[model samples]
Target: MRVILALLLMAGMARAGSDRPGDFDYYVMALSWSPSWCALEGDARGAAQCDPRRGHGFVLHGLWPQHETGWPAWCDSDARAPSRSEIRAMVPIMGSAGLVRYQWEKHGRCSGLAAGAYFDAARRAWTRVRRPAALRQPDRPARLAPAEVERAFLAANPGWTADMVTITCKNGHIQEARICLTKDLAPRPCGADVVRDCRARAARMPPVR
Candidate 1:
């Protein structure tokens, strides 16, 4: 009886550990503000993103598949890292090679696609959204309310309502904009927990370098 009970417990534990890809309801496409990321990465500025010549604006951070409460990460067993070519392909959009590898290991593993296909999906999601012109040409540093920022994004991308996106900030600086998508990559409303407005009344946007 003791042996049988132990086997039952092991089976239950195995079932609890079984989270696979395609188990998510939606995805959140995160786009980082390059200048904000550069500022945040302070002495560690050697990243390609920190270089002014990169001419980066909102760069792909990652396309994270999210559950309502928590998220599934590092789901795949093979756990193969992204290749050099895969890293190179993402550099233009993702900014740095190290970030590319990290994103794959953390988020892409749970994406149900190989590294290449995962990045391809990331690119597809990146291209699907439009960056607001105001954000693109912030020649001088400016402060804008989070609602204003969301409006700019909504204006640029028709059909994306306020509930579909959220702005993230760090120390009064706009950091990233996260937009939720259906599994098929169409714009969708983010859950109440995921779409909170920035706490600050206004957030600064550093001038593009």
Candidate 2:
């Protein structure tokens, strides 16, 4: 991915504030806190991941490329949409076909690889991060500090440090955990601003139904 950025820059096609394909330094893998999403969706339950029987835990929100300043979006308008089989395979993590499609059109299009290769890379990146045991669907609601959440992740995933993570929250509820990785998928430090976004001393992690 870093090579893609360099090539685009050399061609002078990637400029500041432009959504050029492959214009990014590293990646941020967002792991959504499913219970928080279910709580927000309320009784709608229209998405497959929201089904109570599924017992979903930390789910993939996206594998996004990041710039030191601001990230790019919708880089390749002409990129082909992913097939039904590809979309279905991501449903276990991404929740819906519509979301899968949207993510590919926006983030994946900028990845320089074709749709299939992009999603395949996403799956590989998602699997690289080990989900912390405590955050994996406890029977009761889990109330924790932001530091504790970061610690759990660092302890579970070898070589992951505090600088490599960003915990997002709403009303003191954990909404997501965004982890930074190198273009080659190795753990790396996130931007300082991203790390400071969620500073809540205490947060609630709704129980997975």
Q: Give all candidates' CA lDDT scores.
A: 0.83, 0.81
- Runs with alpha carbons beyond 4 Å of true place in candidate 2: 1-17
* lDDT assessment of candidate 1: 0.83
Q: Write the per-residue lDDT of candidate 2 for residues 1-209, one digit (tens) a residue.
A: 99998888754532334577777877888999888887777347677677889888898989887776567777865667888999999988887777788888878887777788888888999888899987897889878887788889989988777889988898778888899888888988987546664778788888888
lDDT of 1 by residue, 114-169 (tens): 78888988999999899998788577888888788888999999988899999989
What clash count goes with each model?
0, 0
lDDT of model 1 at position 91:
92
CA shift at 131, candidate 1, in angstroms? 0.6
Q: Which 10-residue window of candidate 1 scores lowest in summed lDDT? A: 10-19
